[model samples]
Target: MKTLHFALPFVLIAVGCDMSPDYKQPELPVPSEWNTADDAERDSSHISAIGWKEFFTSPELQAVIDAALDNNRDLRIAVLNVEAARALYRIEKADQLLQIDAAANSSHQHLTEAEGAGPDGRTANHYQANLASTAFELDLFGRVHNESEAALETFFATEAARDAAQVTLIAETVNAYLQWLVDRETLDLLQRSLASREKSLELVTARQEIGLSSKLDLASAQAAVESVKVSRAIYSRFVEEDRNALALLIGKHDESLLPAEASLENTTILEDLPIALPSNVLLKRPDVREAEHQLKSANANIGAARAAFFPRITLTGSVGFASNDLGDLFTTEAAGAWSFIPQISIPIFDNGRNAANLDYSEVRKNIAVARYEKAIQNGFREVNNSLAARRLIREQLDAQRRLASAREEAYTLAHARYEAGLDSLLESLIAQDDMLAAQQAEIDALRQELSNTVTLYKVLGGGVLR
Candidate 1:
């Protein structure tokens, strides 16, 4: 035992070298900055540095996002996934250390007279107690170390996935809320149009009875009122459906928190969101970071696979006391014993199993590298698309607003001309139709502008760092 103890330190020193291959981060092909017509001035603060509560200034919308984060089942599952990966990492780390157990046992056996060699048969009794570590691998080739590292990387990847889920949730919630408000405003606009059309119908009817307007004019006015009614019905349906969508996003059926009578003009979402350099996306985006961690884990797996081709050594030892009498189990009369077992397993012949494992690990690493690069590429594309929209959408919204205002003025003049007997009822109806369509377009454009901003905020990896 003493000789073995003296040689243990030398044995560890001799076999301390790890057979695992050295790890290097995979190279990714990426551009330094986004390809925009004009470089956007860099913001002093990053978008991700802002929390959802701060970015979305609406108290009501912020409450909805917070509720979704808390109650959404998918977010709950993501959090649980992170916890499971963390527990798995802890288990793997624990496996790298020695496991010792204390044990006590008593045994009794009856022997026949021929076997006992006494005048009569007798029962034999035994008692034992010990501390033991069984088959603890030495990790000389770094197989265990690599596996633990892979587990740790996997845990980090899951954490990133959870963050990605959170960012998506917040964006979806905000978009749904904005859409609800826009639909409500559209419905309100249509109802007001309906009231004006009803008054026009009454005016035309009165003129026709007094022989000032023809039957054709009265019929046109009635058709205009019905058209406004149809539009109002459609918009009312949209408002209700938007409410339903918001409920689903918040993972609850509560209606009290719905955005009440809000309009595109009054709801507060920032028109200007800070843009980041394309290269920084890899660091800010959680999904991209998650993919990178997955790639790293695959790289560590390759090391574990390589180490499998080498010999594995294990050690099991026990030190204890034993006595036939229970009372003397811990006394000086008790027998003291100890054991040391050193085992080596070398792969002499395998039908290419180890080689196949190494090949599989390498293939996995290749797949992970491709996925990592693809994630970065996709992230860059999203940011570019958002930036492009950010550049042009404001112009589109401005044009839509001006068109709506001009159409409203044209409708007013047309109605006045018809009333003063200078224009046909058909002309007034046409102008009114154009005005309604223009108003609807303006509302839609406003919603689009808001949705694009939200998309940019999300694609740029906002709402994660906080």
Candidate 2:
């Protein structure tokens, strides 16, 4: 027994060599810095770490995102997926430990005289009880360990996916709310334009009757009124549609909880997000993190596959009491029974299945590596595109606002001149048309800028609600 005990340690030590390859993170082809404005300083602290509540200043907007986090169906599914993956990982990890069970059995048998039980047929009864461990494979080459590691990585990947879903939900909710505000603003402008155009048509018709304006000028005035009416109807529809989208994102159609007619001018989200290094995006973005976890999982799979080519060892054991009488089964008079089995399976010959598995694992790892790199590349592209838009959109929005102001002034002056008999009705109508278009353009630009801001937030892995 002493020698047996001494030799068991050596056996375990000999089989402790891991066949699983070491995990080396795949090198990414990422730039050191982003192509941002020269004045923009690099921020080591990624903006993604900011909480959603802290990033969004509007109480109404924050409430909307909170509702979505609680009620969004897709986000709920993502959370459930993480739970399932965690459970699967636990199951896989449990395989590396012993599994013991308590067992009890009774048997009856008839022995014939030819079986040498007795001259005549006799009945025999037996009873036994024991604790036994079923066949448990020893992780000599780390097959079980690698498999567990893969499962753990898979769990981590699902968690990252959940975070990615959360980011999307927040971005969508904020964008929809902001868009609703823009549509409301445009609708108000169109209504005011419609009223002005109606008054102009009345003035032009009165002048035509008095021989001060031509029928053509009157017709132009009428067309402008009808055009503003059409624009009003379109924008009103946009407002309603935007409301419906927001309701869906929040996972309920509670109109009372939805944001009331809030003006875009009053709405304020964070204007500047910290700009981290391009490579940091991989760590900040959940999708990129998810891809890295998948790569690690594939790497672990290769280890498991490699281990499959080596000999597998398993052990089964039981210790029990046995007796012909059921009452005596647990007594000292009962016979002590025990069993121990150590199994070894050395791969002799197979139809190239093991080699094929190894090949498949290698290819899968390659696919994972490619995917990981692609994720980084995609993240970099999104951040760069958003940065480019961020730099140019502010300029565009400012120019549009200035043009709208100029057009408004021109329309006011032209209208007063037409009423004072110093200008033609055609001139006033043209100025009014230009002003309406310019105002609408300004609103559109504002909406684009707001949408771009949400995109930047999402691409930068803006924080999820805790």
Candidate 3:
């Protein structure tokens, strides 16, 4: 009988089988080299260590970034999600080992015989007590291992997702702050230009009264001054709105309290940017790592789904004692128990549930692979676009500066010629317009260049999340 029992275990092992299909990842569509980085040297110092302080270089902006990271609602949510994933992974890992549970119970019962005879039917009282009960499943195969690994991958994915959120948050804050700076600078410029135009109009009108200028020229100069004032008014409102936007990005909306400062010209700089490659290794952006983790998690799920077609072997057991007398329940002489029930479940038919699951897993794995490839391609595209944008903006800035300088010189010459009766008032007006336009264009180019750098930081996956 003992030999038969030992052979039964081997027989059950043979009975368990699976028929689920295997999973394969889809082909990658991404290129080996990124379009932007023609030569991204893999050096140790190539990575960006430019933190919020170094990148922003403004005390106020750094403070705002710190506050946003501390108070942002989205960041709080991401942190909670990471905790949840960690808990789930821990649970899955713990489940791999045996789980034991204990229970205590006491019962009393009275029974009466339904028959009567020379010996009359009598009532009997019984008492029973049990201290604990334990049950566990023995994992002989790798089912638990696959499940644990899947859970761990999900944990990593969530963690990476949180980091991705942080990167986006920082980028948004920088963009908002820069926008506020530009608006402030533009407002100041408009105000100053309006004042200058008003003074020019007064001078031209006085010349007309003295019979040195025509009435038509005086009217044109006054009209131009009025238009500048109108523009200044419009820009004033926009400046307030931009300040409000900056407040919102920092998780606050009280514009008066935020105290936005710093002009764009003072804060923005266009120069030869350092190209760091080695530091990028450590800054493995959350999105790229997140995509990879998602793929791994999907791969693990495929293993679990394929396991569905296979039979499962489980060993169930229980040991306990029950007695008519509560006092004797703990005694070994009164022990009563049955245990060690090992069973094997073979999947004879499931109406295609297992097959469908296998197919779903395969499709999901394919999707994950595609998503991973797309992320890489998108990352490369972003890098290329940012670098190109920066290059173009720098060139534009150079051209605008030269144009502004020429226009300024022309405006000075035209003003002197008009005073000497050698040039018309229209010529001075046109020169001033050209100068203002060129100055505005230079501002635009510089702001765009800085914005491009921000995009570069994001595309290169800066800001490590550790």
lDDT of each: 0.84, 0.87, 0.70
Which ranges of candidate 1 are over 4 A from the true structure? 1-16, 19-21, 116-120
Q: Write the per-residue lDDT of candidate 2 for residues 1-466, one digit (tens) a residue.
A: 9999989997888567666678888776778777773455567788767887777888777778888999999999999999999999999999999999999999999999998887888999999999999899988889999999999999999999999999999999988888888888889998888887888888888889999988998889989888888888898899889889988899988775564556777667787787777777667699999998998898899989999888898999999999999988889989999999999999989889999999999999899989888988898889889989987999999999999999999999999998898988889989988998899899889888878888988998888755
Judging by lDDT against the true structure, name the best candidate. 2
Model 3 alpha-carbon drift over 4 Å, by segment: 1-52, 113-136, 254-261, 265-283, 320-340
Candidate 2 steric clashes: 0
Candidate 3 TM-score over all chains jointly: 0.83
CA shift of 99, model 1, Å: 0.9
> Whose TM-score is higher: candidate 2's or candidate 3's?
2
- What lDDT would candidate 3 get against the real structure? 0.70
Q: Per-residue CA lDDT of candidate 3, range 148-260, in tens?
A: 87789889999988877877887787777777666667777777888888888889888888898898899889888887788778878887887777666667765443464
Instruction: Rank the models by lDDT, top first.
Output: 2, 1, 3
The estimated TM-scores of all candidates read 0.93, 0.93, 0.83
